[model samples]
Target chain A: MRYGGDNRGRLLIIVLLVTSLFLITLDLRGVQVIDGLRTGTQTALTPVQKAGSWLVSPFRNFLSDVTHLGRTRNQMEKLTAENEKLRLTLQNRKTADAQLKQLKGVLNLAGTAGYEVVNAKVISQGSTTSFTQTITIDAGTSSGVRANMTVLSGYGLVGVVKYAYRDSALVQLASDPAFKIGARIAGTQQIGILSGQGTRKGVLQLLDNTTQVRKGDVLLARGSQNGRPFVPGVPIGEVTSVDNSPGAVTQTADVKFYTNFSTLGVVAVVVSGSSADPRDSLVPPKPRPTPLPTVTIYATPGAVEPTPTPTATK
Target chain B: MSLRRFFYSFPIFFTVFLLQEAVVTQMRLPAGGINLLLVVALIWAALSTPEIGALTGFGAGLMMDVSQTSPGPMGHWTLVLIIACYAIAFLGYGDDNIRGNPINIIFLVTIGVVAAQTVFLLLGMMLGQQVGSVSNIAFLLAGSAFWTAIISPLILKVISFFHANIFGMRSQL
Candidate 1:
């Protein structure tokens, strides 16, 4: 009897293993049955996972803080005064900066590489070991965010939206290998394709061999035909290194992106608009139109003008 | 095969799973995070019958597959973990010394983790997924195995406590 039980147990293991393999094969074959099962499982579990994650966030933060207590304390000691000073300074500077940016936006409206901007906040980050760099944002279709829309930060281009859920969207970072953006060397017409390097950085390839690109040259997105994925003139990154040899037919350059994908916070989704150069916003606004001088004129009974008014002429 | 044992052991399994996903993954330790689920599987295989071990592994693997940040096809991890747990359970079958000894437990856990990881990576490669280069993958596997082994002693204590209190099992393991 014991022997029979042992045999049955072994048989069960074999069956489970084989069944799992069969399922894996079916899934690999693009079977909709397995896909549906997997999606249902995910959709059903996502809420629970979200709630668990939310509940654990404070614990995670506390744990992180505890782990870095010593370093944090030392840094705090050093930065306390600086923080206080900077807080006051930044408070004042923030208002000025807002005013400045707003004024610049208005002046550059004509030059705006026109794209409607919808702001979003990052909800959560993907796992560190995830195959692709992606993030979930709090804004979605309700906020005019849609798949393939370009996300941007104050510094530069961020990524493209991959999936737009009801109240959230998944943004595939520019560092993802699957992502590609048409880009150009800033200040020049030289165009290249910006492709992710699978690392934090990116690469601009397919530059004309004759085009000379120096390190530190900025890169800007080359808007698509419809300008949905990338609005033209949005800063992408800066050239870190140029790989052009004397006999090479094509050139490539490594790009150091201005926007840090890992620490993304508030971002703007390019919803719709005419593509305008973001760089134009940095230019000082044209002096406010000089207010037309108030002129007072009186007509005599014979409709004679004030011909004796030498002061008016002055 | 005792329903009571299975029912009692389940909460322990669920707790470990939550720890693996919620806490361990968030640690960001220098050597990368330890696979707590792998350690749990090792403990389950050591203490339980092959059938039970396989079931536990399958359940854990399925949860992992579904909850992965970038999910792949389901059942890949399930197969890997089942095979790993069953093999380990078979190796230590009816051997109280092997099952109860810390050294044996550590060795089994290490081997089980390496086996599961290698199979998973190979399967991923077969499916045209670019798991990193072999050398890097091997390094990661070794590192994770070592970490799992390092924490196995603590995990084993927790498992033993649950086994004694919840299941009322007097088995040595």
Candidate 2:
């Protein structure tokens, strides 16, 4: 009886130790385990998340209404002006309908493959202390919004879906410290990796200092290399200021996002598969260099084209 | 373990957690805001037996951790609260009858607030994250202590009344 009790205690200790070791290993690995755990948690908590969302929906709507009421008049005027301009542009474009359609078809074929946009309402926001800046949206599994879905607003790319439940999904915003987007300057075509600095404002790092870039330049998501995913030509933000650090090969700049997250009401979620060549389709083909004229001077008898005198000094 | 007692306690705990997450978190002083949870935990510890008080504190801390966005592992909070509760119970300053003693509640809550902040700082250090500078920590501790000292009397009175009237506990109040 004494031996059996001692053995049982030993077995219990061994089991506890092994379990702890496994957990520690899982924590150290980080990405794979966290991804799996988040997905599983999303799946398991789908019902609860949906219920919680529904419970908060009324409050969110009321708050949105009150906020929008303050700016309704200003927004209506802006919309009316925009409507007139768009109508005029549409009429002119229709006159060249065939040529425009052909161009659009060619551009669409070369650029984005089949993709569709879905709109989702922001439900809850992640707290300040949370590691990632994420927001829960109303669309989810039923809406075809899945993990890795790209989220955007009128301004540009907002984030990617980290996890999806039945009626809601968490989107890790582009402003999150861990987020990195491959981007390029719109005019200069200078490529760089845009990283979030965790400020209310964000910064993009240009890898090559030699690349000509300036403030007021627009940054666009130019896609990613390897199997990494990104949306092409999404307007990221405008460069507010540039910093050239001493002895560093790269220049960094602060980007002020056009999407005002503080007043974010409606946003569109783009449902698309990972593109192999996100940048390829978005970048306009380089303008063909103008052929240089070959200068040939023909010397006539009377012209006496300046005679080349070797050793004139002698 | 009575169903009635469980029902009453559940709402109190739930409300405390919700208030901590929402309102209290938003209340930022120049230094740091009040830790109402610590104040309540301390009052409970002072009014109960040492073992039970420690257990209650652990449960409260566990719930707080769950409702928080802390990067630390789970159960870290349980350990901190248990220690705070144990210290309060071992001091033996307040009595069961002293549950309604406003001055005594204020003194105990002040101590508990300091103790809780110290534990949080220690935990952050052990976890290899510098939450803030020493001056910032001291500012937070003093701020919370002052807030708790000012507010504990009214909270204690209400809590005592609930314990007596709703919980059917003997009128310590």
Candidate 3:
């Protein structure tokens, strides 16, 4: 209830605010000192956080299960027989399919191209602030996981490992605005840079203006010299739409990713790709485009003109 | 600020921080996730003195920054939370009734969450992050604020019970 002028309290608040601003400035400026502090603190707390996660996950599961207990019980009893019958029916088919694919030289071979991978569990999704699109996996440096290692689900590329602690590591999702990959269009072999649009869809910027890419064309990572961060031929996504801006030097298109980041479960970390973090090749993020106020029409006879939609093309 | 107050409230902040990161964050809602820690900080700040409020907010924000998975400028949350806690404490300095009324706590939490999130978004944009369109950020802020408000009362009651039991004081509610 002390609302009166307290100079000491005011001074303390100012000091705290100033200190916070200083920390932010230092971090933004990429001060090596603060980076060390961040790394050290993160390393020290990883164990405690991991232990806390272990203790809390079961309780969380129990709470969720209880909430859906009635429906779950009803479905469980009904599905038990069906599950057994389906399991028996699919077992032989799965084995036969695997044998067939092995006999043929046409399998999505994960480690065929001199890259070693380790499977890791997606323990957590996103960050506490939720400002960045990232996830934490259970594997870390202890399990040969390191920074800049490519992470993927069964479908395709997910992201690259950003940081690795002793027992855990952080994976920056491919949908993060800052993420980019050098990719090539399947069949056409046209090179382009794929960047995240901070959503499910990514934007692929073609290197050549004249490059012809169509919808449903699968994009693959054009892995670097050693394939460190991104290995060659990993499926990224399929092109959904191409931007046809008149007289544009570089063409852009919207890509729908094969990996579903929302429900990411078991992901593998490619431990032996690059000697160094290969993130430098990615193009720097451009500022979000300001929305257009109006549209212009170019009327022409005997030619159908597509409506020009304002978009950020870089 | 009394030493007892800081010691007593810090645990609640830490516990809330852990739960926010571990449990609450896992339930990713459509319009981004709700920040349960911000609500806890606001409520705790409202109940304590300005110094305690500011300190608690700083601790909570620091924990969040540490636990965050991505690499961005640190202390953004710390700065936002500290200022928000200070403002909340200033506004409720003489309002003893906030501690007793769960509805008031919910309302304060809703407003506080929105204010903190606005500062967070603006600062994030300033730091060269391509944080989507204004409408999208606004939608997320409002959704998260609403979700935080909905759960503020229950969370506050639990924290209050813990604080009371630990300190041998009567529960605020």
Candidate 4:
């Protein structure tokens, strides 16, 4: 009877090993059946994952708070003072913008670029077993999200949707080593391939080396011909440093992606783009000194030019 | 164990997988974070016969392969985990010193996770997947092993209590 256990196990292992080998072979060959299996699996587990995320969020936050206890306390103190000031301001009957900063910023960014977007919440982060950096979002095919579609935050490009199910989608984060995108220097035609190095920064290898890529130059997605993956003029990152190597046909530059994938809360999926490319229209405005506040109690319209509404709305 | 006895493990493994993906993965940890599912699966396998151990590994591997976050071809984790967990089962089988001791179980899990990941990396590279730099892989494995060891005691007690309830014993399969 004891020996029976070992024999049964050995036989089962052989069967399973063969099955796994078969599956791997077909998957590596890009078989449609395997893809279907993957999709089916994703579809089945997405709901469970979403529900688990909901249940796990409080615990996650507590752990996060514990890790950043000192910072949390400091923020608490700062927010308490800010709360007092906001309370006094609220007494004046002025309406406060209560929307999520990321959501509002994304909406404003889409408005600037004229891309119709479906806003979505980040449901969960990467899988524990997977080597890739990925995230699951609450939007999917029902919201017109398609595979290979561009996903972005208010700050800039987040990633591309690798798989889109009915109600949820898998996003390959921009920080994954497998992530790659075509980028162009802002205000110039110098295009290149930008690939992630598994960090906040990416490596941009300019296709044309003759055009001296300078430091601090901004990069934008060149956009696929049909825009299946990306839309033109979405800011990608800024060049931090350039590789200066001899006998090289291409020069690489280090760029820090504009969007911080770690802290992503609210993002938007571009269902469809505008008639125009909205070239350079979505570049995050440079930080400027806040205009001095004038205490003109009765001053209303045109008293002082408040930061000219970032762009003239359509 | 009979098929009925094994049925109890399916939901346990499933819940562990969900917790690993949903709660554990979301945490910003130093070396990628803990593989709660892997640790639990190994410990379960260690406490059981080789047959049950292989089954647990296969089931857990399928869950991992189906994950949306996995980038490699399907069945990679399955292939690696089955072998690793099967080996662990054999190592711990018929051995009281390894099964009854928390420290021994800790080492078993730590070694199991590291060995599985190492095999995964070699296989991934063979299949042309970009696994990352060698140093990065080393750091990730070390961190995973370190954290799993640190938490194995708590996991050991929890699993012990749960298994005692289900199997009617703590240290015997």
Q: TM-score each candidate.
A: 0.68, 0.55, 0.77, 0.84
Ranking by lDDT: 4, 3, 1, 2
Sort by TM-score, top down from the best: 4, 3, 1, 2
> Who is ahead in DockQ, 2 or 4?
4
Candidate 2 residues A1-314, lDDT tens each? Answer: 01122454345334433443454345445647544554554455445444554555444444444556666656445545777778446434532463344335333533353335667766556543323356667788889887776777655667778777777777777776667788888867888888764444567788777776678888878764332256566667888888877877678888877555644444666675344434433333435766654544556687846454333221
- List iRMS for all predictions: 4.5, 9.3, 3.2, 2.8
Better of 2 and 3 by lDDT: 3
- CA lDDT scores, all candidates in order: 0.66, 0.59, 0.71, 0.78
Model 4 lDDT at residue B136 = 59
Pairs that collide, model 3: A228-A273, A228-A274
Model 2, B1-173: lDDT tens digits are 43345246656766676555444433222234465676777776665545545655666765654532333444455566777775675464344434445576568768876777677657656755434334445555676777777778778877666555544565345
CA-based DockQ, model 2: 0.09
Lowest-scoring 10 consecutive residues by lDDT in candidate 4 chain A? A90-99
**Tens-digit lDDT track of model 4 for A94-197:** 21232277888888888888888888888888843445678889898988999888888988899989899998998888877788899998877699999987
Off by over 4 Å in 4: A1-9, A30-33, A66-73, A78-99, A289-314, B1-4, B26-30, B134-136, B164-173
lDDT of 1 by residue, B48-129 (tens): 6677778777777766665434445778778878878777776776777777686788888887877777777677767766
Best by DockQ: 4
DockQ, model 1, C-alpha based? 0.22
Every candidate's CA RMSD: 12.6, 16.0, 13.0, 7.6
